[model samples]
Target: MMAATDALAGVLTQMTGPWPVSAAARELAAAGVPVFPCVPGGKRPLTEHGFHDATTDPGQVEAWWRTHPDANLAVPTGATSGMVVVDVDVHAPTDGYEAFERAYRAGLVSRWAFLVSTPSGGMHAYYPATPDRAQRSWQAARPGVDFRGDGGYILLPPSMVSTNGATVGYRVRQINTGPSATLDSDRLRDFLDPRPTPPPTTSDDVQRSADVSRLATWVAARGEGERNRGLFWAACRLAENGVPAPDALDVLTAAASQSGLGEREITTTVRSAYRTTQPQARPSSTVQGSPRAADGWFARDATVRTSAPGRRLS
Candidate 1:
């Protein structure tokens, strides 16, 4: 049976030039399979022609570079002074490419950067590196930064310049010089780490909390299943702000009325049933009365009112 990489090789082999390969394409290449740079011709066979002279221009190559001046071209082999190349495999959806470009531009302004788009929409960003070991040492200190000298990652043939043509070995056109003239490799490392930070609680969060509090109070006046349903609604509301389900349930039970139903019963019922049920049983058109206007003892009393203050329920 053909392996996954082999299957991808077949797909990449079929595309024409002026195309970008996604991250999946890179994997296939890394696995020793050749993928042609797709252009007008259907799948030209991969050869040394792919990485041929970096000084020559193929048809459509100049126009492609003009359109995407910020895009990087991969340096398949050899070391260039003052450039760092990072091999990145972009998966499908290519959602994060622009962000990566922004970050790269910020840190390496005035320098050339290259990104070879893989078959699956991922890219490799290449930058010029300082030739001195000391300067290069600082560049390598940053994780994910490559100096191209250490067998870091091979640029394969059939890779198109990001903007246009499919002919390989074409020199990458450098358009705008990056604004970041110096490489602060340490800061760059921190900037790229994927750790999450908690957002500061805002006035909107306070308002949401107040809304949930009022809801809990209204639910306390209701008996049994209705109270459980209210608790579930409040919990769901809190969840929109990243509150965990169990914690929201605890808060709901604590705020519920002590006399009408046991906290455990209400919480359990909410967890098992109310959480899964629709907010309202009947269609909005069929519902005759609001909870505030219903002909009930609780509805009549001011202290047991069910109406949302300063808001309408439609």
Candidate 2:
């Protein structure tokens, strides 16, 4: 998901143009993404307020640059600019590119996208912001990656920051010249900020998973009055999830026996429950159902989509 640090800054090496911060600001404002100024040779905002002072006004932008000709260009993220950025420090194999790779294989980031080469040899992948609530800035999702979402901003192309007594600037590695539209970030959030995996739901771990264990215990504790009903319900739960009828029957029988259900009643209840839950009647075809029958059963596949297809990233 990241290029080498050498290649990171190389993203903008071919540039041959005037370092006109004001002109760049005008272009961004014309694109409808608001802009602001950060003190040149530094990232401190020139405006009294920080990102909140971002403006689309050409006059303000001209005046600000006129006052401080060397100020860097910063764009507020979130709704105003309609974008979020994934900040990747190009320290692969050191900081956490391996961790980032794991997330990437898990489908965390889009391979082809626009990015801005950062001043500190980092690359910022830009994604259109989703329409929902603003996402707050996140620090170090992995060792090398950070996120600038809602309530945050990024110093943009043609913006210079000082390093090693010299000036380095951000440049558009991938340029978006079309109408800005949202990029689906549900996958990014889920992958970067994943929930811990719960224990598996294998028969061995049936007791390990709280939901299955609770249901099993509920069946095993039923008394005479509730014995058949409990066994049927529990068996039904297993069968509907395509547990083999025999496996389901075996579990229900053991639990019902402990609950004082006679053998005949246990067999009849389990068989009837299985029949209703598994319409195929054959146990061989019982491998198709919900949570109880999944690989990483609690795993949810998040939807990923571009706001619009064919939007070029230059």
Candidate 3:
């Protein structure tokens, strides 16, 4: 198979003017680049399996276009096409160009093979794929930027899309004359949308975590008749106090087992409690800051005196 750059160059040579979608699809396939047909004037794939059905065989390419001659041209991203794209979206009041510009300035997105102007006034920056590892596709919706890599596809030039009641083609904007480089998709995404910093853990948070152990011990000490009901009530308190279902199950499972509860029964009871009370659960922040809120949740059942119940700390 031809390298992606050479194949791209071959496709570019054939794109002198407004070429037909069938011819474009044929040229791409002939260049060793897999091609597929999409809905006319749109990005949605027409084939049953979508991008997975993309093929480089000239015969298959011809059959696809013959059936849907006006269909838009699409190519799979990442290793399938040996290329990846940074899609800069242009939804009104949420344009991604500013975020992209920031990434460019930070040296996070400096090496692009080419640029394509999308019908929606956005841009697509193409890059060579890193051969050593796969880069999965992802989107930073808040920043309005998306990465098209493995498991994603993009429309090619001369393929028109309906935008704002007007039809426009995905036209070539610029070609890189110098060395083209692969993109660090992970770095780019982190730069565009940094994860929030976690709040500092407090003393109360420490107490809350320790309290869970005590609560479990209390559940294990429950007498025969009260075993199931005690487990249910403990699970409900954990849920209302914002303890994640998994953690609650982990702590409660062993304790409930000690009280003769079966594995299935433990899981069912814990899950039921989470489903019933989690929606109305107080936020961790509220529970952590207010001693009364934490105390209130534990006070709901004062019978577990020896090992007092408490809100979960995250």
Candidate 4:
């Protein structure tokens, strides 16, 4: 029997993976990569949003390909594909390509899973968009190199480019498909998109966490009449830094209850605190009798989208 890699190679050969644009689009869409159309036989976007229009929905993919069967394919770079592409161009006369070589020789760019050879004699080195790397596109940060990242898109494989009846299509240059190949490479990330300063280390995190914990402890020790006022003050402090209301309620409610407040009292106090914090979201003074009213309050505030899991960013 053939080796697993050989088997996958054989399977790839049977399908039009990087061949006809429609087939390439279908395959990529199925693999969770959002695909959108560039102009048929050209490179401009067919949709208004360009790469933002990329969707993994099979039906949308089918519908798009159905309408523009010959359209060129493009996928959003960065987190959309869970990747960023380091584009090194041989066609350009700039020193960017040379800069890439220097960086590579310096033992940078040591991580990448696969690469695509572009029609213009350039290459797109694919690497995962590691969460901490802060991936974003750059043009000529070196010379002939570009980063196809947060706001960039890449021509999908098998999408043909032709000039004056001469055709040149992107083709796969390397394929391992192993876990190492598929995983994001932090080293390669540093080479392409180095942060000016190191990311914040654990010291700040540890201090903030300790501070919050101490505050929680103090709130939990408040006595009966002061329970609501204490909880409200604590919730406001948490909200000042954009902590999610639900989380603040969870922490402070536990604190309030230990101070002898009832469930209804705790809920009302927290809700009022949140409303006062977000005065724009405040409703009329009258109370509604809907059974789901409390739930509605929570849901309305659920619009707070978190940057980190426990905290929202303003």
Candidate 5:
């Protein structure tokens, strides 16, 4: 099994060049491997496709193909043809695993999806076909979800996977059965369609920003020790307002700097808080009239003021 795995890894290294081959190969080598090589049509090449070499044993390559006959050499087509790949790092106890699972399940239901789980517990979700479609799908599924489509997050490929030595690339395996290369129009429609009117925003949503500010103030009052706590709440607040991660990171950084907390500490606290609670939800009113709350915490908080009608913090 190890030899076979190593052989598969080597083949991927030669073909893809060094983005992250081992991780991709691990997906192929998993117990119920979801990996598929896309052949343009349903036809297998007569030769080895020149992917083999002295270091890569021919028998291993043939064996991999034999087991994964659905793997294709053709360029991916249809709606998913231009799909962008987003890499998600699942930092174990963080929101990474849950986020990937939720996104994957959502995609399965939407038919506007493709996802791969890395050996490191991270995930890469791909939207089929068009870049615009992918971006739209991602935007419609932001905050709780992370998308790598255009100008979004960075996708770090496995170390040995590359298009050349410099550019990173992913392996494209064509599906021979189960589904056609054509895009699912319904799925595409959903991808292109605007999100349904959000349930009328509640007071909770509006007060959420204030609640975060209050939390920040509370942390600040506890001396510089709680600075990270303040930044965490701040990031959550900004993220709820549709801010991107980088922007949220910046907000957290600024908040931390002002409060005398380390960036790493702030980042860790925010990520930890994100894992534990839904940041968009309003904070408890118990903290409302506290010392932190008295310091103009709620006054300057935007998230609190924007909560949908009838959902104010109690």
Candidate 6:
């Protein structure tokens, strides 16, 4: 299995030039890696079930490509592919290179097998998957970094994208020859987007505190179709327990952001929850001196996107 995985890794990292999408798909399948077709020039899956339709069967691979001959190539990440990816996004006003560099300097993301330059001038650092357990995918919107693990898929080299009226490919940037290392995704995420340290509970806080930390963590893990509902539910719980509106915002803003909810959406949902549950409580105009305000991490607006459970990143 290890040898097969190495060979599969080679199929991606060793490609020095463009290969026909179908050919690349076949090669990956022949290497024991399951593959699926994505919309040409885009990341959307062409099949009915997206990445869930990935298969190692040569017949299925051939059929899919025959139907969508110009389709892009993608593979399910994590244990299925024996690999994972650290996606460093580079966009206007947000660049993950610095955050990735910080992780590298801290000895957190050093063992990548290869690096793929994304069409959007971003990067994908491929690493070997940890054998003992599953590392689920996560998004740290503020840092502009995303983890492609158990519930995600990534387009491969030579897969082209239409960017700014010019076509660009997912090109291999560098391949490591030395020993490769696995990334501690959870630790890396915490470092990139550290949660605010809760302040010491005063008499006021004692009356309102109700396992805020655990509730925040749960909020952060909520996925699409449930993010708004989850945030509202958590906020209601906190409000019912006397957690102040300002305090609830401080705790949940970052968590909801991590789950891919935008700043406006988070604030609205949380405020609505508090208003619905605490009709008599006065609403504060601002959250002065809150832990989140002290850290200034939760104030920045970040666009977050998350994969559904057992689903690919969309």
Candidate 1 structure quality by residue, lDDT tens digits, 172-201: 221212221234443444454433565898
Model 2 scores worst on lDDT over the 10 consecutive residues at: 284-293
Pairs in clash, predicted candidate 2 = 175-314
Off by over 4 Å in 5: 1-82, 86-119, 125-146, 158-197, 201-233, 236-269, 273-314
Model 1: how far residue 292 lies from native, Å: 48
Model 3 segments more than 4 A misplaced: 197-314
Compare the candidates by lDDT and give the number of the best one: 6
Off by over 4 Å in 1: 1-82, 92-99, 102-110, 113-115, 134-149, 156-184, 194-314
Residue-wise lDDT of candidate 4 within 1-314, one digit each (tens)? 11322332333344443367787677667766678888765555566545667887889888888998888887776665666677765322343445565555465543454556566555666666665455655444324456666656677566777744567766665543443222234454456545567457698777867777888898877764576788888877877766655556546644554454433355467667778887664423312111211223211112212122122112
Model 4 scores a TM of: 0.52
270 Cα displacement, candidate 6 (Å): 15
Query: Which of candidates 1 and 6 reaches a greater lDDT?
Result: 6
- Root-mean-square deviation of each candidate, in angstroms? 26.1, 22.3, 20.5, 21.3, 20.4, 11.3
State, as a TM-score between 0 and 1, how close model 2 is to the true structure.
0.53
lDDT ranking, high to low:
6, 3, 4, 2, 1, 5
lDDT of each: 0.36, 0.57, 0.71, 0.57, 0.35, 0.71
180-291, model 5: which lDDT tens digit per residue?
1223334433443334556777898778656655654554444444445556666666666664554344334433433434333555565555544554533221111111
Better of 2 and 6 by TM-score: 6
- Any idea what lDDT model 4 has? 0.57
Q: By the lDDT metric, which is better: model 1 or model 5?
A: 1
Residue 114, candidate 6: C-alpha displacement in angstroms: 0.6
Least accurate 10 contiguous residues by lDDT in model 1:
281-290
